[model samples]
Target: MANITAADVNKLRQVTGAGMMDCKKALVEAEGDFDKAIEILRKKGQKVAANRADRDSAEGAVIAAVNADKTSGVIISLNCETDFVAKNESFVKLATDLATLALNYETKDDFLAASFNGLTVADKLTEQTGVIGEKIEIGSYEKLDGPFVGAYIHAGNRIATLVSLSANVDGAEEAAKNVAMQAAAMAPLALNEEGVDSAVVEKEIEIAKDQLRQEGKPEAMLDNIAKGKLGRFFKDNTLVNQDYIKDSKLSVSEYVKSVDSNLTVTGFRRVALA
Candidate 1:
């Protein structure tokens, strides 16, 4: 067996996120070959990680990147089992780099198979699993490209949003970014009422009527009551219809109107820890 020092184990532990003892054992098993040790750790991680699947992974990071030209943006969710691991510098860095890399991928499946730094994304995750000793995954990815694109990553990296805007304003990037941040914070479902699914609208109307009847409202008033509630739902779920966070007097659509910009939000995405 090759000699493996405590320093070597510590170095591996830092690099892989694996425990010190696990790192030492892998190094010893691999005869102190760092590359072989990494492989050994990954194999072990895959075996042990199966049991961690059910652990609540409600803490993680959302990362977003907007291209220099503001023509493209990507948002991704990198989920982990614990807040401690989610806040780890290594994990945050990984999430950032992955979001940057994912800009070239148009679909989630392609992104997963794409090369990340030196290894495939799946391999990279497996290696990270060995190091971090936690279950982590890429929960979602979204990309948008248009005349202008903007992104917002909320504090704590828990939420991220990407929005593509068609606006002629000189500061459209900044404005779109602000709006994207609002969308992430408010959890908007659509750009406007028309953008929402008809099925969803019908479902909401049904729920509204049921609630009104339970409240002892007359059947004759249910339609009118549901219509009023639907309007409120639109304000709650639509980006353009929402109350502007910066100014309560203006809706987001009204706020955007000041720039004389024909703002058409072509795409938007939001991701949060599940």
Candidate 2:
């Protein structure tokens, strides 16, 4: 058998993110053929990654990445079968690497078409599917971008949110991320009162008026009832009006009062399992 050098093992480790022993073993198994050794370990990991896919991936991760200047961010939900696999070193590595790839692609089709290692992202997932024998999937991919952005991945990587701000400020990105975290938990519709659709408001008033009339409320009271109901609508749909999950004493709008008034939520995206 041809002697495998330490240099060869290190090279494989750097390329594959596998352990020292695994690299050495792969080199030996491939008879000191570096290229073959790389494939050997990759195929093995791919199998393990794929086999883990079929298991309920409810416990997998939410990964996010931002451009160098924090002008753009990508958030992704990568699911595996169980918390065990979710915490697996290989699984986490794959998820982060995939997130990096996702940052460059705008859509799912584009992401799948992109290359990962020697295989297209889609093919890698397919190969992993075959190996893990579980249902592995890219649950969601979201891109939030503008002049400035921030991202937050909640515990267990189950929830991910990205926010874009209109004006730059100290800790502005982090504050926007808090808002995103609020959106993930509260699921708001509009960033503020003005952002809410007037049509939706009108429709909501109509519904409230109808319900009031059905309840035998006097017509005079119907208008007041409709107005009163509108408050609930705003509270439920508008981010500024919604209760801040972090601190219920203040609405999300109230929380942002200390920040620059111009720092509006230009856009945001929240992702979680269906």
Candidate 3:
């Protein structure tokens, strides 16, 4: 067996981001051959990952990345089994790195399968799960593209939101951030009433009518009362119709118009661990 030196272990650790002990052990197992040592570590990770496959990974970090043009962005969540591990330095870095990699990916499936360093993302997550000794996974991913796109990761990195706007004009970027923040805070059901699912609208109306009936409201007034409740649903649950957080006097639509009359939210996605 080739004696593995500290330099050899550190070099391997730098190359693979594997733990010092793991790197040293792999180097000894591989007779100090660098590439072979990496393979050894990967196999170890694969084994651990497979063994923990059934474990629940519900805690982790949410991270967002945007391009220089501010016209594209991605929000991703890297989940682990424990809050302790989720807040680890290495775990957060892995989340950020995957988010950066998400820029070139069109779908979360492809991003997970995409290569990073010498390993696919899924492989890397498996590898890290071994290193971290936890069940880990990529929980959610969202890609945003439009004239203006912005993302916000709430304080704990447990919630993230991405907002896309129709025009990339003056104040668009700032407006986009405010809207993304609104999304993170208020969690509107849809961008607008037009974007609301018809079935969802029907469900809201039915629930409203049921509540009114339970309150002993007259049957003849049910239709009119439900209609009014439905209108309130649009105002409360739709992004554009909801009052802006900064200035409640204006709807989100009016607040955005204050930025640029032609600018408006085109799409949005919100991901939260809770």
Candidate 4:
């Protein structure tokens, strides 16, 4: 048997982020061959991932990254099975690194295929599933690009948002981040009434009409009342129409306009841990 020294086990541990004993066992299984030991560890990860395929990875980190020019941004949620693993420093760092790398790819599939320290992002997540003993995966991925874009990550890494503006002007950073925070806190469904889906609008209108009928309103009046209620729904649920959380007197649209008359929130994306 080839001698599996302590240094060899430690090196494998560093390279694979596996438990010390697991690294030692893998090295012994590979007869102290580093490359073969790494392959064994990867196969172990693949096996663990397969075993945990049905598990729910509902808790983890929500992270966002924007390019230096602030014209584009991406937000991603790296999900795991438990809050205990989500709170680990190394786990948060991994999420942060993934978010940073995600800025280079426009789609989740592309990001998963991108290289990370010689491993694809998807492979890394599978590998981490074995190291952490939990199902690990990316739960959400959103990208935005415009004249200006900014990101905000809520405390504890539970929520993240990206906001895009109509123009990149002075104070755009502050404006964009403030709007992004509003998005994180309010969880707006869309940027404006025009952005709302037709199905959602129909559903809200029907719900409003049903509520009016429950209140004993006449059937003929239901259409007008429901239309008004739908307008209120848009104001409450749409990003630009919602009242600003910081200064409720002004709408989000008004607040952005205060920064610059030409400035407007063009788009936004939000993701939260489930």
Off by over 4 Å in 4: none
Best by lDDT: 4
Clashes of 4: 0
* Cα lDDT of model 3 by residue, 14-105, tens digit: 87778999998899889989889888988888888889999998899999898888888998989999999888887798899989999989
Estimate the TM-score of every prediction.
Answer: 0.87, 0.73, 0.95, 0.97
Candidate 2's C-alpha runs over 4 A off are 1-59, 192-214, 219-224, 246-249
Candidate 1 structure quality by residue, lDDT tens digits, 152-252: 88899988888877754677877787789789879998988889999999999999999999999999999999999999999989998899898889888
> How do the candidates rank by lDDT, highest first?
4, 3, 1, 2
Q: 1 or 2, which is superior by lDDT?
A: 1
lDDT string, candidate 4, 1-274, tens digits? 9998899899999998999999999999999899999888888889999999999999999999999999989999999999999999999999999999999998999999999988999999988988889999999999999999999999999999999999999999999999999999999999999999999999999999999999999999999999999999999999999999999999999999999998999999999886
Evaluate model 3: give its lDDT: 0.88
Error of 2 at 60 (Å): 2.8
Candidate 2, residues 191-264, lDDT tens digits: the string is 77688788988899999999998999999889888999999989988877888788888787677666766666
How far is each candidate from the true structure, as Cα RMSD in Å?
2.6, 4.7, 1.5, 1.2
User: TM-score of model 3 relative to the true fold?
Assistant: 0.95
